[model samples]
Target: MQLLRSLLADRDWSQDAVLLSRLQQALLLLRDPAASLDEATWLLVADETAHYLDFRRLRTLEAQLRGCTQDEVRYTRADWQAARTAEAALASHLRHVRFSSYAPEPVPMFRIH
Candidate 1:
């Protein structure tokens, strides 16, 4: 994954956090009665993309199951659970690592010359 490699090399924590939160929200929406199956599937794909961006392997086997068939792409309950677990763990780890690295120092205020 070029995306993951780029994200890791660039280390843009704010962008990563925003994307992660959006992925989390998408996951929640996937569980809602009003959400379409297609929407849920797209959310899962988005979740996978976010995970890839974070350089994390998708915890769910569903990530592997994706694109297996043309008609059906929905993840099983177990798959969703695995995805959630992976997302939570990766998000937590990223938050801890990214935020902690900057906590000790104040950002420099620049005066344009």
Candidate 2:
């Protein structure tokens, strides 16, 4: 996630078709449920997919901004906010999964009453 974010943050990354292709390839693996990845990796993949979908939706909405009416603006903004919220949820889920992976399993204690 950090590496992809770094690449997206770089202006040159947008211009690099090869890098974009590699990213798409990686995303396919991440999105596939049969990849046999660990739970943490799957969570990261789900988070990344959420971000990717959000970005695509926002970009589509942005392209419609040129002749956007007031209502369109409101709609676009709402959609963007929704995307942000989804991304936050994905991040939170990923964190929870990773944290739980390290936690010791609870052992039940029983005694004769």
TM-scores of the candidates in the order shown: 0.29, 0.34
The sequence of per-residue lDDT tens digits that candidate 1 reaches over residues 1-113 is 34433433332222446665655455555567796546655765566667453333332344455745412444333554566787889999999998688456876898998
Best by TM-score: 2
Q: How many backbone clashes does candidate 1 have?
A: 0
List per-prediction Cα lDDT, in the order shown.
0.52, 0.58
lDDT of candidate 2 over 57-90, digit per residue (tens): 6656665865764334433334566767887899
Regions of model 1 farther than 4 Å from truth: 1-67, 70-74, 102-113
- How big is the positional error of residue 85 in model 1, measured in Å on the Cα after superposition? 0.9
Q: In candidate 1, which residue pairs get closer than 3 Å at backbone N, Cα or C atoms, i.e. clash?
A: none
lDDT score at residue 100, model 1, on the 0-100 scale: 80
